[model samples]
Target: MRIINPNLENKLKKFGSDTAHICFNCGTCAAICPLFETSFPRKFMRYIQIGAEDKIMDEKLELFKCLHCGLCTSSCPKGADPGEVMLGLKRFVLDKLRRNQDV
Candidate 1:
């Protein structure tokens, strides 16, 4: 069963993902990303767009793979700045992890 977090998109946006909503899954970001082997920017954006919080959380490693190189951002046709989105996701995940840390 696939779990969905409808608030995920709003959470991401509030976390500073300004261009998260602009992504249309064109795959341009993934194609231009050097870390495509690790699956990022595109995958993360898709998860955010669709509000798949569980999926996004499951792929925490993939989120960290982003180098913030800006290649994906520069090549994005929609000017979504996927690199920045990745950073935002990273921040969100980190905050979640911190809050859930075993004390």
Candidate 2:
């Protein structure tokens, strides 16, 4: 896969998880998402799974739109925890952005 930035891969790897492997991309995150009544995490998960790194970066503003309310995490049958994924991905992306800015 084309990784727009490999740093995120390394950061994500640090979590050392197969936690997301079981996601199956079901829409439970969407259905239960307090934000999904307007915002969406389901589509974001798909982007991450496919290594759609540019799209992820391009859509950065949308990620922060999450209210961090935890409904999506609690309701996921696959334990996909979209809320955690959102937080993790934000850290992964913005950490790099901050590093880049300092350089």
Model 1 C-alpha lDDT per residue in residues 1-103, reported as the tens digit of each score: 7788877867777678868778888888877788757445787888877778888778788678788899998999998889989898889889899999822
lDDT of 1 at 54: 84
Query: What global local distance difference test value does model 1 have?
Result: 0.81
The C-alpha stretches of model 1 lying farther than 4 A from their native spots are none
List lDDT for all candidates, in order. Answer: 0.81, 0.71
Judge candidate 1 at residue 9 and give its lDDT.
Answer: 69
Model 2 C-alpha lDDT per residue in residues 60-100, reported as the tens digit of each score: 88888888888888888888777878887777677777978
Local error of candidate 1 at residue 51 (angstroms):
0.7
User: Which 10-residue window in model 2 sums to the lowest lDDT?
Assistant: 13-22
Give the TM-scores of the predictions, in the order they appear.
0.89, 0.77
Clashes of 2: 0
